[model samples]
Target: MSKSCQGLFVEFVKCLRESDCMKASVEHRSVTECAKVSEECAGLRYTFFRCKHGQIDPRTRIKGNKGY
Candidate 1:
């Protein structure tokens, strides 16, 4: 991915953290997989990912924010 896209993902994760929207027991998954599954899981946005080799990547967005 390009640097700008990576930066966006990081920022999105940071926003989730700042808003307390991420889950505690979430396991890291690929960005592609996360994008696919996020819609199915309530309140679970793509926070980050780790590849088979343990490389870390992150993606983020708000979920289950019914009050706001």
Candidate 2:
């Protein structure tokens, strides 16, 4: 990847690690809503991304299907 892309990847990983405390709340919300509240793909963005893409696991606390 390009230097900028690599930097972003590193930042993303750091951000996710830093946000490991926020658990996903189960609810029902559209991708539009998730995008509205997401901290720019950092903390809960990954959870919402999984929800939007239908890849979230229902068994976890982050049942991301909700308005996370």
Candidate 3:
């Protein structure tokens, strides 16, 4: 993981931890179950994805990465 995306990753994890899906997953000892309700954190996920993609994409590098 790149240092630039770490903050986004932390935000995404915090969002996940706040969701009901994650609470239930913790109760059931199943982590993957939270993925079903991931839409709640879609925006953060997309931003993180873009940040990671930008690291390897020449066009994004030239154009400048989208800011959070």
| Residue-wise C-alpha lDDT for candidate 1, range 1-68, written one tens digit per residue | 53424554565455444432244325655444544544443233432322211223222222211111
Check candidate 1 and list the clashing pairs. Answer: none
Tens digits of per-residue lDDT for model 2, 1-68: 32323444465555544432333525654444544554755444554345445433456435433432
Per-prediction TM-score? 0.28, 0.30, 0.70
Clashing pairs in 2: 27-66
Q: Number of the top candidate by TM-score? A: 3
Model 2 weakest lDDT span, ten residues long: 16-25
Candidate 2 residue 26 Cα shift, in angstroms, is: 14
Candidate 1 deviation (Cα RMSD): 13.4
The Cα local distance difference test for each model comes to 0.37, 0.45, 0.76
Report lDDT (Cα) of residue 28, candidate 1.
54
Candidate 3: stretches off by over 4 Å: 26-33, 62-68
Cα error, residue 2 of model 2, in Å, equals 1.9
Question: Tens-digit lDDT track for model 3 on 1-68?
Answer: 76778899899889888877776665674545564457888888788888999988998777666645
Of candidate 1, the 10-residue stretch with the lowest lDDT total is: 59-68
